[model samples]
Target chain A: MKAPDFSYFEAQNIEDAIKYKSEDDEAVILAGGQSLLPALNMRLSSPSCLIDISKINNLNEIKIEGDFINIGALATHSDVMNNDLVHEKLPCLVDILKMVAHAAIRNKGTHGGSIAYGDPAAELPAFAVAMNAEIVLSGLSGQRIVNAKDFYLGLFETDLKSDEILIAIRYPLLDVNQHLIFDEVCRRHGDYAMAGLMAKVELDQSKINNLDLVYFATGDKPNVGQNTAKLVIDDGYDYEKLKKSLASEIDFAGDLNSSSEMKLHLATILINKILNKLER
Target chain B: MSAKNSVNISFSVNGENFDDVTVPTRQHLADYLRSQGLTGTHLGCEQGACGACTIEMDGVAVRSCLVLASQANGSSITTVEGFDDEVMQKVKNNFLKHNAFQCGFCSPGMLMTTKEIISSKKKLSRDEIRSEISGNYCRCTGYQSIVDAIEETINEIN
Candidate 1:
């Protein structure tokens, strides 16, 4: 598998990377290159230039700022899984990370890279949306922050401009009362999830205080179960009604492996299972 | 913005340094290593599914097919041959005792991953060993033997 020819530029800093991208009409930013390289080799995308930002050391720190934990764009999935801050602050995110691809891939794949790729089936993007994490993008114009809900526009697409580079992601620390649960049904262990659900629920002594459900791999983008959430909270956490309401609210076109109706059914099953687990 | 179509890179492989080596920017690390007469790294699936191209980059296992040669410039890499003989001696003995392989296409990559698992020094169960080598596809053997071999090696180490 040979990739199309393209000029490569190793950027020293964020400014140089932005300048290189701004200059080229067909340019792609190289972060971990776990996703982009496979695309390049398969000829799915042909760019005139590749601005490699993997060398910039400044974009590789995982820090905590007050109430939020900041993760650098270049931080690998392995980094997130092993990072003490992520494990202590956001164990749900770490749980999702374990289900991603394989150990070797995670050792090289980056967190922001997967989110920027905007794969609807990817766990991180849906996880980001459920957590309402903030995505940081840097360009020649300076830095701009976009909420995770607004970051993903559609399938394999993001709000990032061509000349912009993703710098870091900011996730608010989980609250004491908040419980996050994630579940995904895939054909194989490492394969992309056929139907995945991640939710952050706040319970006030058995009464649902707040619930946010995000579904992936079943929609064009990560679909927030807003109406379903409202139905559950307003209806006093009725599981049966929630299942039926959720099945009707979320729509997905199944692929070769499963049917459209089956995908929705799997989503409902995953949701019910996760909610039931949370009750304990 | 002065990017080069083919760039010169410097990297160390198997304890040897190769500086000022020019390669196509689009070339992957697996292809580059093969070009340098290091065919131990197999290219099972360039799409990063099959882990036949697994290699050690800066002391961690990574899929070489997904990593570009240019991206690995100035880094230290280790292939199957770079793996120490002392460690592999025990793995090979356990593999033979368990009949770990058949066609041996996935051996080099499997060995590299197995090396990583052993070096981690974690007490691994059979299921955990199976999970660690899940990336490396072995069609010849039913993987039971492979898991047995790895499990026995872990036991020996502990």
Candidate 2:
């Protein structure tokens, strides 16, 4: 139940951290150690060195820059959940944050680490994709910004280079006429979602102008329900009939938590439940 | 500076400062605490799921097993044995009054998480309390007694 022997380096800054990564190909960055420590304890991953970046200055800040809210990589789920900026600017994220694992896990699990880990069942990555956020990656070469929809490639796979570190994520602010909903069904409250949805809708005079739905934990990546969104919006947000047509529209794959067929069935029920509340 | 396998760490536990103690970098805070004879912090599902190793680090409750001792080098940790406050005393008394445990393995971490909720000064509903302590799992007692105890404690304090 102990992590394997590995050298530790407490990085002084982003440059210093990238320098270490550049020097060692098998080094892993330690953000909040929520996921990495568990992997290390289970011996699932045996990196030669662990780079502790918790001490890096200016990496855990949440700031509102222009029309976007920028969250640093080291910002914990608790930080994002409790931040007034997040509540006022992106309440959809707050809704998802509240449902993220328990308080203790939220206290230690970081936003960047969660995004970097890229678990398809996780909330932050799904939220990022639904918001069309931007992921900022920093390396010795400099910084590059990738759209959230393109950041994640597959299960536990991301576009982040080995030598690059996720510095921050910028989410575009929701317009005054835009409304969002994030909901999931798990066996237990703190457990991973069996299937979830993060929906963003732009409404003009109670009529839907645009709608986007990102389904999580039902596929290899956070899948955008493009056909369902188009159909539902075209049907005037009438989820009653629209949901019945969604089983064939969205693609789902089975996992231990749920079966593919069940997830397809549950997605309709869950989306309808959320839309019902919105209508009420 | 050359990286050393073992580094000297200094931290405060229960209001006492122990400085410059050499420890392996990979040692978890829970294991380190137990090694120092503070066995109240129990370990269950060391992967941070069970939450038996929860402790207060700089006033935030965190799973100690997931946190490296080296990460807690400068942190002030308060374990279950060192919890001495009026609110915690009330909580402890409520646990006894409510018979909150059959097996004491999860008590220490449960109490730590409970303390955090009380200190936060929120008016959490019954379901909210359950959600708040969902991280701490108790195999025995079916958790109703624990919830009753917490609610009773909050009601008394208010």
Best by lDDT: 1
- Which pairs of residues have clashing backbones in candidate 1? none
Global CA lDDT of candidate 2, please? 0.87
Which structure among the candidates has the greatest DockQ?
1
Cα lDDT, all candidates: 0.88, 0.87
lDDT of 2 by residue, B68-144 (tens): 98888888999998898888889988899889966899999899999988887777889989988899999884589
lDDT value, residue B60 of candidate 1: 95
Each candidate's fnat: 0.80, 0.78
For candidate 1, the per-residue lDDT at A172 reads 90
TM-score of chain B of 2: 0.96
lDDT, candidate 2, A1-280, per-residue tens:
7899988888888888888888888888998898889989999888888888998888999999999999999999999999999888887787788888889989988999999888888888888998999999998889999999999898788998878999999999888888788788999887889999888878888777888889888888897888888877776555456565666665688899799878887777777766775676
TM-score of chain A of 1: 0.94
Off by over 4 Å in 2: A236-251, B1-4
